[model samples]
Target: MFVEWMMGLAPGWVTAIPGLSRAAQLKALGNGVVSQQAAGAVRLLLERAHRT
Candidate 1:
């Protein structure tokens, strides 16, 4: 799913793990960071800071 990609995780990182329940998988994904999105947010903040 796109959420996995957002987390910068490889395919199957969430869904393919043996013994993981669906709810657990969802919780893990929910707790993950969207690395690229975070980077962009930080960059935007830095740019605005520099402009001030």
Candidate 2:
């Protein structure tokens, strides 16, 4: 369905486009971003950014 269409189009790349508004799309983008950041292994960045 929608997931198949998206996965087919992007092939595992989740990007936050200008016109995409679906929760699943947003969640995909969010997860992609978080995964990328987490892959960097910079845990201190989260703490520093949120420790205001």
Candidate 3:
């Protein structure tokens, strides 16, 4: 439950994966972040800061 929240995954999303344990799912999610999405968020923040 905590892992799903931390990873921003929808409910039951983790259980859909086959053959992976909960621990492994949590580990992978912890280490995973979409680089493009992160970059976009940073850019948006910077732009907003500049405007303020």
Candidate 4:
């Protein structure tokens, strides 16, 4: 359930591999970042850059 929620929070479309091993799936999920958080960070950086 948690994984599904996290995936849903991603901004773009996410694809699931059908035959991935458990370890691979866990690794992918672990490496994934929240899209909304990343976008916010980028927006803040751009705003700061614009002020300079």
The best candidate in terms of TM-score: 4
lDDT by residue for model 3 (1-52), tens: 6766665668667656889898888777777785567989999999999998
Tally clashes: model 3.
Answer: 0
- Higher-scoring candidate on TM-score, 2 or 3: 3
Residue-wise C-alpha lDDT for candidate 4, range 3-36, written one tens digit per residue: 6477654322233656777677667777888777
Between the candidate structures 2 and 3, which one is better when assessed by lDDT?
Answer: 3
| Residues 1-52, model 2: lDDT tens digits | 3453434444434434556567776576545444444556667776777898
Per-candidate TM vs. native?
Answer: 0.61, 0.25, 0.50, 0.69
Instruction: Return the clash pairs for model 1, or none.
Output: none
Q: In model 2, what are the clashing residue pairs, if there are any?
A: none
Scanning candidate 4 in windows of ten residues, the lowest lDDT window is 8-17
Give the local distance difference test score of model 1: 0.87
Name the runs in model 3 displaced over 4 angstroms.
Answer: 34-40, 45-52
lDDT of every model, 2 decimals: 0.87, 0.53, 0.76, 0.68
Best by lDDT: 1
What is residue 18's positional error in candidate 3, in angstroms?
1.2
TM-score, cand. 4 vs. native: 0.69
Candidate with better TM-score, 3 vs 4? 4
Clashing pairs in 3: none
